[model samples]
Target: MRSTTTSASPLPPRQVGEIVYRPRVPHIMFSGYHHQPDATLETSRDLWWHTGDLGYTDEDGYFYFVDRKKDALRRRGENVSSQEVEAVLLTHPAVSAAAAIGVASDLGEQEVMAVVQVADNTELDLKDLFTHCDRSMPHFMVPRYYRLVDAMPATPTGKIRKAALRETGLTDDDWDAEAAGLTPTRHH
Candidate 1:
């Protein structure tokens, strides 16, 4: 197999259960990965190439790209988009920046965790943030864990490093809403 310029990564097959841009019928997605036959084989199956993206088509047949499959959170048996969660979080006046990621759940799935940076001269109130999030999105999509940080780990290009946030496993600074009895109940 000849190596093409590049083919990105394929998400872990376990996370591929929900959303991915796979070719239903035979189509040329990519030539092959450079010097990575295992990766090539992992992505291509039975003449189908899994594009490792999380999304769904609306009733009108418009494909909505949610997140990378690897970055998506599986919460309460639903696929949650970290990007969508972050978008809701960012709307809060106290949040300067936010990064939503998955943390391990006792149920052997992933739970949504939001790492946030507060705006200058503003204090982030977890309860207020929760109420805002609850109003802005579905209950399951609201973050279960929240961590307020002075600054988010970022690349030189200013992209939040979600990988870095995930590496900090179960920190004391992280707040668990379930333990705190903060539920996202519907308001009148």
Candidate 2:
């Protein structure tokens, strides 16, 4: 169920790409999307079911899933890992939970963004967060846009529902450091 590339060629470990699979057994593949022929056609291409999950395969053929294809962001020619950004955000005391998503950009493929949740009665300081992230991450990885929420929309299993957050992306309500002329100059 995990594939790095469609071609049968040796690749270095952890070279991330869309994970895909084709049934190894005879006629064991899933039929089609229920009442969604378009989706099925889109998915079943080149004899592989393209899983939207981004991942990589090791030399041992073990697959390591990274980010979702849509969740991955490229900012100013730098690849930004959402999980890495979220890890730094979670270190802040004011941040109870955070979700990093890609914002549509006219200048590039996408820009980095942070959707965060703070505890009730707790104040989330934008300056401090900017400083914290500036110290922990490179400039390209630091979020360009930030939005604070009372609580994050979550999946049934308690995972942050980033798909839902993407619905409200790059909102006017989000605090923009660049607009305020406060985009931190990266030191590390």
Candidate 3:
């Protein structure tokens, strides 16, 4: 079932929060967590079922998925949105689609790693893509590593399966911009 948020007011439906919440219904709500009384599924106050998913709302009231709560990356003490990074990457003419995932970093928190699919018949240059990102996004949000591919894995419903990419982690073919000593200076 597609998770939805219950409208807070009588006004038209709009995004209430990051987590998807649905009102309690007989058949709709589950009968609590099995054998885990401490693991109640309902939130503190509204009792809305927590979906663990994170997303944003468009101006037209459409919910656009960003990433799962677990997939959120903590880099340099900031929460970097994978979808936000992908959106910037897509702006490049050579990029067709992109997926940003967090990989373990020696500094303790996760570092950004992006897997990008280049446009048909276009060869992606790591330096050029890095330049685009440096000019487009914040320095910390820039990926430390990148992997160019022909296509990205997607679900039957057309959603990018980020978990699969995260499962693979880093690869030998992935280019490491940080290791190469290419530091992105803040453009702004």
Q: List residue ranges in candidate 3 displaced over 4 A.
A: 1-46, 55-66
TM-scores, one per candidate: 0.75, 0.80, 0.72
Angstrom error at residue 48, model 3: 3.0
Give candidate 1's whole-model lDDT.
0.77
Judging by lDDT, tell me the better candidate of 2 and 3: 2
Per-candidate Cα lDDT values, in order, are 0.77, 0.81, 0.77
- lDDT by residue for model 2 over 1-188, one digit each (tens)? 34445533435687777777778897787789999999998888877777787777887889876777777888888767898899999999889899999888879688788888986678988878888888899888888789988878988899988889888777779987777677757845
Q: Using TM-score as the measure, name the better of candidate 2 and candidate 3.
A: 2
Highest lDDT against the true fold, candidate: 2
Write the candidate numbers in order of decreasing TM-score.
2, 1, 3
Model 2 Cα displacement at 62 (Å)?
Answer: 4.2
Clashing pairs in 2: none
Clashes of 3: 0
Screening candidate 1 with a backbone cut-off below 3 angstroms (N, C-alpha, C), the clashing residue pairs are none
Q: Which 10 consecutive positions of candidate 3 have the poorest summed lDDT?
A: 7-16
How much RMSD separates candidate 1 from the native structure? 7.0
